[model samples]
Target chain A: FRKRQPSVASLIQGIRDGDKTALSRAITLVESKNKTHLVQANQIIEACIADKKNTLRIGITGVPGVGKSTFIEVLGKYLTNQGKKVAVLAVDPTSSLSKGSILGDKTRMEVLVRDENAFIRPSPSEDSLGGVARKTRESIILCEAAHFDVILIETVGVGQSETAVHGMVDFFLLLKLAGAGDELQGIKRGIMEMTDTIVINKADGKNKQAANLAKIEFTRALHFYPPKENGWVPKVLQCSALENEGISEVWQTILNFKDATADAIYDKRKYQNKFWLLQTIEDNLKMQFYEDTAIQQQLEQLTTLVMNAKVSPFVAAEQLLALHQKKLK
Target chain B: FRKRQPSVASLIQGIRDGDKTALSRAITLVESKNKTHLVQANQIIEACIADKKNTLRIGITGVPGVGKSTFIEVLGKYLTNQGKKVAVLAVDPTSSLSKGSILGDKTRMEVLVRDENAFIRPSPSEDSLGGVARKTRESIILCEAAHFDVILIETVGVGQSETAVHGMVDFFLLLKLAGAGDELQGIKRGIMEMTDTIVINKADGKNKQAANLAKIEFTRALHFYPPKENGWVPKVLQCSALENEGISEVWQTILNFKDATADAIYDKRKYQNKFWLLQTIEDNLKMQFYEDTAIQQQLEQLTTLVMNAKVSPFVAAEQLLALHQKKLK
Candidate 1:
């Protein structure tokens, strides 16, 4: 299959016609780092987005030990059973740590793995975090083109990748353990404020009471937080993925959120779209400046001087920027 | 004074010789909007920073009615009595709002006003926040050149100006009222993380007990926050500027922070200096791009398309950037 490469036209057609193989191939093409493949990948992406379907994009995140896979499995199976096509994609930028930890154990997702309507893919490794994020964002278009009604993007909540995931998703769900004290330290400071919902997992046996206590604490804490721009108050609830309890309620909550903020969510997506454009321009401008040989040399010496307070950062930056502009002119 | 323009060499010499008039004039030059004065201002700044002294730069912020002026006046008089020369500068970008609210009332700071070793300047009116921040940061150098041992920058705690102040200051002190609920609403979130010390003011009269309770709550909350990069935990304390109480202890706490993180603080300043240089370059590049007439025309059209989702932001940005780059080449 690698030897007989399919054309971009056929690939787009297959994706529109709901060919799973074409969808997988398109994602692989986007994940490829080869120069030639990049050109073709962008072309395919452009075509896919032209006829893009509106899919529900949900981002799920939690620390390593917080039962993310178990929850995703239960949720994915539940959705598939309701005749909804689900695609599970991972955006683990720290690919080294979560290489085999997520989605590798097929038995963990036993019920969903056997279902024809479900698709699961591991995170793309061997790329920069930006690269991974860009690929994952592009892959969402391909997944939707293949008629996936629901797209769940899973990311490890320990690193900077959560911000990237948050930028691309419609609804952000933070999974937590019963004991919020120690585990909360692993999460970043502003993560809670960005969260749309907080789910306390492992609510069975002795942990049930602790989970209930956590729900109350989180609810009270969130009340003190400034309201999000969309006016959706973040909800906190407990679930035992192991017992498959409270699963439907979580789904209902999500539906309610969508209904309540239906008008505002479109505005949010438009904002995200425009934000990515500006972000790309900013990143590219910085890249261009740093790649210049003259600027890089001045930067090294200026960095030392600024560090020692021999010169102010503002003056040093002005000098460096002037040099770059002169070279450009 | 505005009619007689001083030579850059004379201003530099006067600042080095501890002349306050020269220092104030230098600050005015730096704040000038005239194109001709900009070149001279840069030259004067270059000279001032060449032999800049390490002054203790402290940033103070709080919402309206938090007794910011009273606290500063008490703190300023206390420092000057201990044989330290102090300079108080305001970084209020919204000068319109705080014109008569802060320091404008001479009776509020009667003691500090009569002190020979103190200097107080209002915020520069009719300038952008960036413009105000730049001028205030430059003014710090001028103050230090005149051998001021301590510099206190005042800013309202409501907007983006706090982050700018945080970028330029060595230690950040947040002034809060005893009423945590109403006062907290005025202060933005994520700000407490940036503070080095949280000072609860107006702790006299009926507010004393409430102040102590608020202190305990803040201390407990800080414990959950991530430790700062320099390993210094943010301290929360109650003070009664009205009664001139806890003034010495607050100074003692500041000295202790200086002693404990002496080496790390120097490194942090250097990092800040270098950070500003990069930031200046980034801002300038964006400004230049936006200023181009052709690109501005393209940007307006692309913005509407991106916002309406008629075109993807990535693609729209690519088109706009390509147009600018083509014109540049």
Candidate 2:
């Protein structure tokens, strides 16, 4: 038989005392699908709201083979060395299909996993991107309440995950690999606009010259973009995660960014909170509307008719909504 | 005394017989908020669904002062000269605020407006983008039923209207002017990814060299983007709308694109129909939920709390949702 779960009061007390086990359990509760667990999770979260600490949330993303794991591990170690308690989490929507391809193995971040001041959690391999993002967001609160001073959220550069992660973090860093002649081709549209900094990874050995060239190219390209709303010009830096060089400079850049945009950070977080509030409500509303059995049955037929141009989409949408409202009544 | 409105069947018959007056009246019905008018509009649209004709819907967007009006007028005249009936529509969401800044004055397209084979409609200066887009989409069906062979949808490049217009059209074109140093600066992110062709307008007199240079730069930039899923490579061309030069070449480029992406166009429209169906339903759901007085009142208070970090956004969202559901029940 499983041991009796701790009460909400004990969990809150443990989290305040910086108990890792309590933090992990709280995150599990947030990720749980069981209704009662969710209730308890909300209660703990409510209790921890007043415990907000001075925290910095950074989001890092790169395409596969960009050494995200090594970069994250090195960065986490650097933060911990500076007496900062660090928490590393991930938001990969495809993790369920890929069986947690990112951060799934503890061996990926061997040194950081063993660091006492570092807390690492793999991507939650369940639900949609909304669900995964919500869980990671709630876990940030739990981590901060447990006194983690820095949070690193990592995501793959593919798909819409970068947008989701960008919405939640204070600074967005993009990792890139130097290529022969198509360095900018791998960068997705709108991503350059979101990036606060671009770190060209694996810049050691024979790739050093190409990495330097990429840095100059990105810097010039960045000049064409208008300055960010916070008045911070994005920077491009070169790093070798495997060799653990240039890690300190990356941290220094983040520090300068924080100092430069202190007021903006406060306002940005507030705006992000409001965004998530509305986003969560909208996601829930859509989920409830789509999960209805009657609406689902009619939707399939209406979709086919719409595809065949036999019915206007607006009219079909009205019919589906009318059916849903009638059932609700 | 108000005149009696034509019946739906009579209106459909008139539209089928290529009566512009009937088409205009039908489009007015589609844009109306009156319950009865909407019912009649749906009936007319349903009756016209089987009337899908061989047509091409082209979306044209450019920044203000890019000579969009001149370009469209010349293009419309060209298509009409080729024995193709052309209908022009606008989808400016900001029209409500800017007093229909785009296509507001018919004098802008004076020449084409007088052509019997051409029809031009200013944007409906009311409602949100979704509402405006819905009206324009329904109007497309009405135009097709009237046997218009080519539909030109115009929008300004300032906002999300390009995306909304992109969803409804067969080919997307971006019109640009030769700028001093910031030619690419005016091009918004994600817009280039959607563009099937870019036309450098006003390529006459002293601007001819600059326009050609811009075309070459755009062509090189377009090559970096991976080929579209439809296997069509985007092209950049120069045009002088004032001189009416290269207008035929632009039309020929469109024809080539049409021949190359025939199968893709069929699948794309089907996909677009399904997307709009779900998008409309989702938009409607959010509208109904947000329009609640209780939700509005509570939302302001919850927003402050969430912004202050005194309450988690997820929890606050849940509270608001619970309240909304309770009222609905």
Off by over 4 Å in 2: A1-4, A98-101, A186-189, A220-227, B1-4, B98-101, B220-227
Residue pairs that clash (backbone atoms under 3 angstroms), model 2: none
Q: What share of the true interface contacts does each candidate keep?
A: 0.56, 0.71
**Cα displacement (Å) at residue A144, model 2:** 1.3
Measured against the true structure, the TM-scores of the candidates, in listed sequence, are: 0.91, 0.95
lDDT top scorer? 2
Q: How do the residues A234-328 of candidate 2 rate in per-residue lDDT, one tens digit apiece?
A: 99999999999999999999999999998898799899999999999999999999999999899999999999999999999999999988877
iRMS per model in Å: 2.1, 2.1
- Output the number of the DockQ-best candidate: 2
Per-residue lDDT of model 1, residues B1-329, tens digit only: 36487899999999888888888888888878887777788888877776756678899998888888989999999999989999888888777555653554667778887888998877766446777787888888888888899999999854688998998888999988877443345448778788899999888888888888888767766665557878788899888998999888788888889998997777777777777777778888887788878888888788777777566666677787887787776
Model 1, runs deviating above 4 Å: A1-3, A34-40, A50-54, A96-111, A125-127, A180-183, A209-213, B1-3, B50-54, B96-111, B125-127, B180-183
lDDT of 1 by residue, A1-329 (tens): 37588988888899888888888888888888786776777788777775655668899998888898889989999998999999988888767455653565678778887888988877777445666777788888788878898889999864578888898888999999978454345557788788999999998999988898888777766655667878899999889899999899888888888899996777777788788778877777787899989998888988888777677767787888888888777
Best-fitting candidate, measured by TM-score? Answer: 2
